[model samples]
Target: MRAGPLVVVGDTLLDVDLQGTSQRLAPDAPVPVVDLAAERPRPGGAGLAAVQAARLRTSRETVLVTPLADTDDPDALKLLELLEAQGVRVVRLPLSGRTVRKTRLIAHGRPLVRVDRGDGRLHGRTGLPDAAAAAVRGAGAVLVSDYGRGTAAHPVLRALLEELPGEVPLVWDPHPRGAEPVPRARLVTPNREEARTLAATARTARSGGYAQAATDAAALRARWRATGVSVTMGEHGALLCTGDQPPVLVPAPPVPGRPDTCGAGDCLSAAATGALAEGALLTEALEQGVHHASVFVAGGPAPRGSDTAEAEPWDLVRRTRLQGGTVVATGGCFDLLHPGHVSLLHQAARLGDLLVVCLNSDASVRALKGPGRPVMGQADRARVLSALGCVDAVMVFDEETPTALLERLRPDLWVKGGDYGPLELPEASLVRGHGGQVLLLPYLEGRSTTRLVQRAHSEGGEER
Candidate 1:
């Protein structure tokens, strides 16, 4: 089964990156004149969180509840189109002013200057729409991406957020100017500077260094009445404080150089919220968030429109299809990741431009191969598969068969490694019905997970 829909509530903005080459200073002024090459526009703030959520949880629905200017406004229209293209469903609230847009001038992947303009605000008189309220109430997990643009401060929306059941995970990414998160929030995340400011305003002790951040986190959690508080310290990582337990520090993986961290915070919150929606423990969620954010930053900014490290599988499929490139897909448990699997995947990759692996979820693997099976969990398995140069994307499915996922992907070619043919294979008919070709290649001789496991057990008992 798919995870419940992810609801991101807060303000939305239009973010644009103007990329160009800057070689020398202008003759007229001391400033360097940039030769513009490309313009990349993407959803910002809550819209960005929604896009990130959708990317991380490909099987789950991601919804954004925020205000937007009328479609007549070019920036707003662009934001809507980008969010839609990213597979994020937006529930637009009425806006009282123009859409907020931020433009950054970049040279060689580094931002030179950022320009921000807009007066967009949620219509103060307009109450939360019924549909948006329902979406918030039904969400499996909620992320309040407060950009301090009034949506998080709205009384009606805040009221509804306050009433959400405790069972639903609530992650609040706070802004200095935004309204305080509801007392029911499960987690409150604030950057180092924001945390320091909030702590000082509350008449709490203020000190320097990472040790002080831990103190700030605990103070903020108590003051906000939240279940946990995490203070994010850029490259140093995040310190998480929950309950009476000792704070845990989740450090960032080392990157070679200074990474452009413009949207790294949103990336972190979105990843953590996605993990929570998938029923991961708080600590596990934070670990995943830190790792994803590091990866996102290390990959550098998407100089163009496409995100480099965290590109959505759906987006890849659409782009490939648009270019008339053949898409190939294969499904399997992929436990242990033996040489047989690698050989088959490499052969399949040769048949198409992009090869997507439909992996069986942990639950599905357990049900099919028994409890002791799947030596690696689904996430680990998927990570290993994605690291393979031959594999383009990894899609996990909970069902016994990947029929539903196949229906969604509708690849041009379906490949499997076995002795089965069109008739013996359960998914062959479905593949053919969709006008897709199915090919079965012989497995590498004497290489299988079952045989490997049996040998391991036999060898263990033989001696040592």
Candidate 2:
């Protein structure tokens, strides 16, 4: 099944980041002194969750419900821009209080301290307006991301859940101290420590051995009326228990190299939500979620020291330059990364010293093609492209046209399929402007991504 429309509600936050290199130790202490390089902010809390959902549900409609203060925080604007770029419809609930901002202090690539700013109060206690309620009602599934910032309190959540039909799925990631007994939720995900806490509270009237753990978890699920319960155990992996199914244990995959564990849980929750929304069974969704989480935890770039880390854009121009070799640059969605794409890449590599393939990010793909496009994700596509021996580098751009990238790379020769005429190609001018030649390689007749997607759909293949 293809992913369907999703609604996300909960606290929204701003993630303020400071990045730099440490050149010397602090005079007062042994801590390294960091020379700031760049500063940026990303959406956090429910906002971050919404971003992940947008990626997974690239082909489906997405709506976000959160309270935001009308303020001058660039971080807030950045977050909004990101959501808009992803084609997500954000329904902002006005709040007089400031948006939550978590600022991290880093030196030499390692985090030293984090400072949080904002009032920890929930806004719009009157309940979701009729319009917001209608939006949630129209969604196929709903996810609540609670960060204990008061946006997802009992009143708002209850109102939203009450509006959802029973068949429409509801998943909850509860805040540590939020109101409990989430009656309408189909599933509840809590980490091992949180599970233990819930268990201890449930058994306050009874005493038992280690069996108390299982008993408590089951009791909590029953009390909440949730069909499924998931307990994330970090490196130990996760355990999923459903009412009628046997408990399933999913072990964590080995990381290729040590990686920072940040955002793994968010990735897991997002993947699970996406799979469930797509109609996958609980077990199947859990497996895919674990797989996605493993990839994130294993493949993220390493941190520097005490300095905040940022991902550097892949330098396709450098990689496509081989000694005494010609360079070929091509850009596209490359959605399926099929054998045809492999053949074209190989053919392009043969004509040049190196092959640099630029891919459209999920957002760009959606803008170019209507909804229900890009059979694969940007990260997945990039990974596949990088793994190919014929491909030298892969870069992701969130633009309808790759003219800017073409200008930056200034390849010796820019190549595209003959399907497009030179007059219609936007990158042609950029390549020519950089003193680079443009070539139109003959496209494989009768072999195109559109045809492949149509055939796959006809054969009952899942859209995503």
What is the TM-score of each predicted model, taking all chains together?
A: 0.68, 0.63
- lDDT scores in order: 0.83, 0.69
Worst 10 residues of 2 by lDDT: 301-310
**List of clashing residue pairs for candidate 1:** none
Return the lDDT, model 1, position 255: 43
- After superposition, the stretches of candidate 2 with alpha carbons farther than 4 Å from their true spots are 1-4, 72-75, 154-156, 201-216, 299-464
Instruction: Kindly provide the TM-score of model 1 when superposed on the true structure, using C-alpha atoms.
Output: 0.68
Model 1 steric clash total: 0
**Which lDDT tens digits does candidate 1 get at residues 1-464?**
12468999989999998977778999999998888877888898998888778878346788999999987898899999898988889998998889999999987556889999989988874477998989988888899999988888888888888887777889999998988889968888899999988877343354556778887888889899998898888988899989688899998765433456878889899999888877788788898888878766654323224444334566556546643579999999999899999999999999988898999999999899898788889889988987787887778889999998898889889999975566767888888899999999878888888888778889897553
The numbered model that scores best in TM-score is 1
Give one digit per residue, the lDDT tens place, for model 2 in 1-464: 32347888877787776866667898999977777766756677777777667766345677888777664855567768866775668887766566678988765445677898777356557756666777676788888888776666757657768667766778888767765636857677777667777656555333432334355557678878888877776765667778655677777765422344656776677678777887888777777777666655644321222111112223123222311235678889998766667767877877776577878989999998779888788888887887676775676778999877777777878888777799988788878887888888777777778888789788987744
